[model samples]
Target chain A: MKILVCVSKTPDTTSKVAFTDGNTKFDEAGVQWIINPYDEWYSLVRAIELKEKDASVVIHMVTVGGADTEPIIRKALALGGDEAIRVNSDSTDSYYIAAQIAEIAKQGGYDLIFTGKETLDYNGSSIGGMVAELTDAPYISLATKFDLEGTTATVTREIEGGEEVAEVALPAVVSCQKGMAEQRIPNMRGIMAARTKPLKVTEPVAADALTAIVNFELPPAKAGVKLVDAENVEELVRLLHEEAKAI
Target chain B: MSVLVFIDHADGHVKKSSLEALTYGAKVAAQLGTSAEGLLLGTVTEDLAALGKYGVTKIHQAANEALNNLDTQVYAAAIAEAVTASGATVIIFSHTPTGKAVAARVSAKLKAGLVTGACALPDTSNGFVVKKGVFSGKAFANVSINTAVKIISLNPNSYMTVAGEGTAAVAPLAISAGAAKVKVTAVNKVSGDVPLTEADIVVSGGRGLKGPENWGILLDLAKVLGAATACSRPVGDAHWRPHHEHVGQTGVQVAPNLYIAVGISGAIQHLAGVNRSKIIVVINKDPEAPFFKAADYGIVGDAFEVLPKLTEAIKKMKASA
Candidate 1:
């Protein structure tokens, strides 16, 4: 079985977010990057698990970013991926990125594809579904559990008030979240092997973006919190009803 | 052309978030000098005509039992057919789990410009700019969707529902229900009175609650306030709470009308999941806890002492009313 796992680089959770160029672009200076937690902990790990169960299963990691993102790809390779593909482009649009992945998937004829449910930075949660549509393959979002037997795959996804247990055939797309798999740190042997693993770079196919960013603005700073005495609980209720009107 | 709102439902009733989307779509239609219509794909026990109070003039029901469960590919195809039949210029969704899964597929099938997690109405004064959260609610982006057809999925709690006196005209719309590639075998419902995603108020605790044994106090508070229960990641990681209750960047992100955090020193990841909430109230022993910085109200006290008192006070207020 061959699986393609989509990876994205995001600012560390603790990074102080900033914008520049009159709030049109993100300020990348002084920012530390990490493999998005969802991608590392859930999507990639699940693919690695599937490979572990079957010796012939191979995992390929793909990302659409500049060369600076190679280190993150290598990190994913160290975790378990057999090879990596870097789509050399700054992926600012979700549709264009999906189109690029769709092109690659069409050419490779991968049996399965995985991506984080959504990126923390943009939180679009659109690419995986779009890729599924473009490829005419089944797509499952926010899958928490997955099992595979031969050509059939069973996935469990959380929906409103309950969980939906779904079964789809091979050659499907699944976006993963928590409860799918536990995070795995790279072992020393895995690290050494990743250094020699092939990291292929490819150009993006021609595709037009449907949306454009006009500008960026930071959310308004939170107002000073009104602190109420621990003993004066009613005062808190008064403020909730009268000032905040939250109740 | 009219505005189309997708009315998501489960357990035979329309979800509350759909009402917000309906109201939002109606208002958008009002702004565009058009009418608002709704598309109901599955079997529902609710009165579809009663939804007119939210501002939609017509409700289109597919009444296909196969559409009862959410299958993204199936839903997207049916909704696309409805869009073509109704000539809907703009489509609205509530950005729930169902919406997140299907909206993109619909957009792809229709080749429409799609925006999710939208926090406000489109700025039509410009060339159709929609405002949505970026950087996980730490920043906002004004996105211009330059497509003949546009799709907007509003954040769950961002829009308020405005209802008035009216009944909608219910009509059966014919559309082909594509075969679902995935077969659902079973459903395991989360055992809670309110689903966290749809809850108006969420009362969450953290490690500061000490242990699972002390959760009774927090649960009591949640019961009094009629809020769903949640936990910080640390509590879930420690196995003191179920993983489903964990709310953070890696967990379930929620945007409710009110979020009450007890004993949780808001980590950046935790805040990312909840910063979109309309109002936040934090209670912690340390006044310098980072959660307080993002909170509208703070109470410096121990959770053990605060939980009971706060619950009692709310109970008193309710009884008097």
Candidate 2:
């Protein structure tokens, strides 16, 4: 089985968010980049687990970014991906990114495709469905559990207020979320091997972005907290009802 | 040249987020000087005509039983067809699980610019620009949709649901749902009066609660306040709470009117999921807990001592009111 796992580089969760160049570009200075937690902890780890179970299974990691994303892709390789493909483009538009990934998936002809439910940066949970549409493949989003037997895959995905168990044949796209797999750390030997693994860079296919970023604005800062004495629980309740009007 | 809103429903009732989307779509239609319409794929028991009070002039339904359960591909195809037939240049969705699954496919099919997590209406003054939360609500981005056809999925609780007096004309939309490739076998639903995403008030516990056995105190507080229960990532990871109740960067993000954090040291990830709340109250024994910075109110006290008193006080306040 050949599985293609989509990964992306995002600012570490703890990094302070800021924009530069008139808010048209993210200020990357002093920002620590890492593999998106959803991609690293869930989607890629699940693929590694599948590869560990089946000796013939090959896991390939694909990412769309500029040269700065190489380090993150190498980290994914250390986590058990056999090969890596980098599309040389830094477009943040969801459609443009999905189109590029779809192009790779079409060429790879993989039996299964995996992506995080959404990237940490954009929070646009749209890529997996767009890739599925572009490739004419079955799609499932927010998958919490996945199992494979023969050619069929059973997935448990989160719905509105519940979970739904569904089945689809191979050659499908599934976007994974938490509970799909546990986090894995790369060992010294794996890290050494990842340095020598094949990292193929490919130019992006010509695709027009449907959307563009006009500018970014910071969220309004909160006013200082009103410290209420724990002994005066009634005051807190009263404040909620009167001052905040939250209850 | 109309604004079409996708009305998402479950168990025959329209979802609250969809109602907000309908109102938003109506306002957007007014901005564009066009009419607002609603498109429903599944069979529903609600009075469709009464939804006009949300500003929709008409409700177009396909009325297919297969559409009841969410099939992303089938729904996308049906919606694309509806958009083409109705000549709707603007499409609106609620950004719920159903909308998340279907909207992107529809956008891809129609070659439209799709914006998810939209927090405000589009600015049509110069060009079509929509403001949305990025970096998990840490910041906002104004996105320009250059495509002729545009799709916007409104984040829950971001827009107000305004209902006036009017009845919409219910019309039958001729659209055939395609065969579903993904077959659903079973469903497991969380049994609760209020779903966390739709809750007006959310009471969340964290690792400081210590164990799952000690969850009763938190539950008591939620019960009195008529709020939904949530937990931090650590609490969910430790199995103190179900994964569905976990609210964080990777977990379910909620923007309720009020969020009360109990025992949780607010991590940046935890804040990402909840910073959108209208008001936040943090209760922790550690005065240095980071959540206090983002909270509207703070109480430096242990959960064991503070929660029961708060619950009792709220109960008494409610009884008196």
Candidate 3:
């Protein structure tokens, strides 16, 4: 089985979010970057688990970013990706990125494509479905469990109040979430092997973005917490009704 | 060319979030000097005419059994056909599970620009800039869409639902929904009194609860307050609570009207998943717990002692009302 895992770089959860240039762009200074947790923890780990079960399964990692993103891609390869492909372009629009990935998937003839349900930074959950639409393949979003037998794959996805189990054929797209798999730490042997593995960089296809970022701003600061006396539990309820109106 | 809103339904009734979406779409249409219309993909038990109070002038119902269960492909196909037939310039959806599943597919089929989890109405002064919460609600981004047709998924609980004095004209929609390539074999449901994502108030516990057997107080409090029950990641990891009831960064991200944290230390991951909530109340034995910093109200007390009292107080208040 051929598996393609899409990876992206995100600021560590502890990093302070800020904007610059009249609040028009994200400020990246002094921000520690890591492989998006959804990608590293769920998508790639599940693919590696599949490869562990079947030694013949080959897993490839793909990312759309500038030269700065290669390190994150290398990190994914260290974790267990057999090869890496970097589309030489800054990740701009979701559609453009999805188009580039669709082009690669078409050329590579990958049977299974996996991505984090949504990128942590943009929170755009549109790419995997868009890629699936472009490729004319079945797509499952927020998949918590996946099992493959021959060409058919059984998947479980979170719906309104429960989980729906579904079956899809090969050459499908899946956006993975937490229940899919656990995180894997790269061993010294895997790190050494990743250094020698193939890392291919290619130019992106022609695509135009339909949306532009007008500005970026942080949410309003939270108010100081009001500590109610434990004995005055009624005071808290009264405030919830009068002040917060949240009751 | 009117604003079209997708009315999501389950158990034969329209979801509350969908009503909010309808009101938002109507507000947008009123801003643009046009009317708002709604499209129902499946059969619903409610009176379609009564939905006009949400400000929609027309309701298009497609009562196909295949449409009852959500299939992104089938929904996208049917909605795309509706968009073409209605000549809708803008489409609105509630940023719930169904919206997240189908909006992108419809956007791809129509080559439309989509903004998911939009927290505010579009600013039409310059062009069309929609403000959305990004980075797990830690920040906001104003996105400018240049496409002729635009699609937006409004965040749940972000907007208010307003009713007006109007009645809608219901009409049957003629469209064919193709068979889905992905087949749903079974559905395993959580029997919670309130759905976690749709709940207005969420009462969550953490490792401080100690074991699964100690969950009775939390459930009792949730039941008295008419809230949903959730747990932190560690509690779910320890199997003291089911994974579906977990609400954190790696778990379910919920933005309820009121989020009460009991026995939770509030790690950054946990906060990331819930910071968007309107009001946060923390109850912990440790006064130095990090969750207090983000909470609107804090009570440093033992959960074992505080929970029952709070539940009793809420029950008393409800009984009086």
What's the CA RMSD for each of the models?
1.1, 1.1, 1.2
DockQ, candidate 3, comes to 0.77
lDDT of 2: 0.92
**Which 10 consecutive residues of model 2 chain A have the lowest summed lDDT?**
A158-167
lDDT of 3 by residue, A142-214 (tens): 9999999999999999877788899988889998998999888899988888898999999999877767888
- Give lDDT: candidate 3, residue B24: 98
lDDT digits (tens) for residues B141-217 of candidate 2: 99999999999999999998999999999999888667888898998878765888888899999999999999999
Give per-residue lDDT, candidate 1, residue B113: 87
Model 2 residue B207 distance off true place after TM-score fit, in angstroms: 1.8
Task: Give the poorly placed runs of model 3, Cα more than 4 Å off.
Answer: none
**Docking level of model 1:** medium
- TM-score of every model versus the real structure: 0.98, 0.98, 0.98
Which stretches in model 1 have alpha-carbon errors above 4 Å?
none
* Reference-based TM-score, model 1: 0.98
Tell me the tens digit of each residue's lDDT in model 3 across B246-285: 8977778899999999999999989988998999999999
Q: What Cα-based lDDT does every candidate model obtain? A: 0.91, 0.92, 0.89
Model 2 per-residue lDDT tens digits across residues A1-247:
9999999999988888999998899899999999998889999999999988998999999999999999999999998889999999989999999999999999999999999999888899999989988998888999999999988999999887779999998889999999999988999989999999999999999998999999999988788999999899999999999999987
Evaluated against the true structure, the overall lDDT of model 1 is 0.91
